[model samples]
Target: MATPYIRMNGAGNDFVVVNALETAFRPTQEQARTLGNKATGPGFDQIIGIEPSDGADAFMRVWNSDGGMVETCGNALRCVGWLLLQSTGRDAVTIDTLGGLTTARRAGPDQVTVDMGRPRLRWDEIPLAEEMQTYGIELQVGPIDDPVVHTPGAVSMGNPHVVFFTDRLDDGFVRGTGSLIEHHPLFPEGVNVGFAHVLAPDRIRLRVWERGAGLTKACGTGACAALVAATRRGLTGRRATVEVDGGELQIDWDQATDHVLMTGPVETEGTGTLSL
Candidate 1:
């Protein structure tokens, strides 16, 4: 049978969303890969399954284009939240995922704000191969004496991420450096790589090479991780605007609660049905 699906994007990180609340459905890894194929199926950075939840408005199952099931995706959650808000006519909604539970609220006509829980800073949390200070890990690229990029901050916003703060945002630099560090021995689980340039105390220009999904236009968790990493290094304030290839996002790491809040816009591309 053909299952209905909705195509949505949050700040250019697009997804194919399946509402399984009424009729439960979960795609296998192969099926996910097929749907993510641009030439063959509905191309997307990730695929989200919105299933009924006992504890929250919905349970989100996320799969990357590579067919890997991941803990969470901030942009996918925001898109799902918007769908729930529109359907329930509520101002806010709660979502459950393998990573954790998060709450999303209406921020504007096409915008949603998600409260991504506290970041995990411990080596065991980011699950590095060994114990080390997450604030800055001793990893480098290029020559030993004059490395191109080094001393990146590591953290987990439900998923492992490492951010390299550098002046280099060139396409070749980001891709070359990001691809090398993504599967480095330090991160036990493959990590999402971020290349960021601090424009000011409250603004950053960022790019991300996502694990399982390479070089996305926008990555919600990557933006959150960037802000957190920058704040930890005393480079940026607790709150800032992150400019990604796709668009802009507002990220705030609450001092009191330690939760990161991401606000961004979501757009519906269209709707379609897919054979599962």
Candidate 2:
């Protein structure tokens, strides 16, 4: 039997969602490569699998376009949360992932808010090669004396991320510099690189180079990380509107709960049956 799939995008980060509850489907590395290719398949930054869960409403599994499985994806979770909400018509839904359990609820039409959980700030959590203050790690690009980018804030939103505060979002700079930092010796387990241009105390312009997905339209965790980093640096308040290449995401780092709340929109581009 063919596998049914939903093509969805959260703030322009596209994904191919497979409801494993309805049809059991898991893609191999080769299959993921083919399916993620815009030429060969529906094309996506990541493919999400929604499976049954005993602890939560559903278990979400994520795979990058390169077929590398990841711990979690914030945007993908929002998409899955929307699916569960539609299916069960519940005010809120809890989804379990390799990272942990998170809850999502409706904020407005097509808008979903996800509790991204508290970020891991310890150096070991990010698993840097050596111990150092994650608030600002010593790394640089360009030249030794005059580096283009330096002192990035490191954190983990289920996955490692290094956020650099910048004044601009140059495509070439983001791709070239991000690719360099992603595999830097400091980050033991690869990392997602974020370039953020703070617009105000409550707004920021951002871009991200995902670990396996390269440059994407938007990164949910990257936005959350940026806010956390900015707040730590006193650049922004606890809450802010992060603007990405795709759209805007409202991120709030609740002081009381210490959990990052991400509010964004999810879109259903199309649906199809996959021949697996």
lDDT of 1 by residue, 57-87 (tens): 9999999998889999999989999999999
Candidate 2, 17-129: lDDT as tens digits: 99898666778988888888888888899999999999999999998988888889999999999999999999899999988899999999999999999999999998799
* Model 2 regions more than 4 Å off: none
Local distance difference test, candidate 1: 0.94
TM-score of the candidate numbered 1? 0.98
- What is the lDDT, from 0 to 100, of the residue 37 in candidate 2? 84
* Inter-residue clash pairs, candidate 1: none
Q: Kindly provide the TM-score of model 2 when superposed on the true structure, using C-alpha atoms.
A: 0.98
Error of 1 at 145 (Å): 1.3
**lDDT of each candidate versus the true structure:** 0.94, 0.93
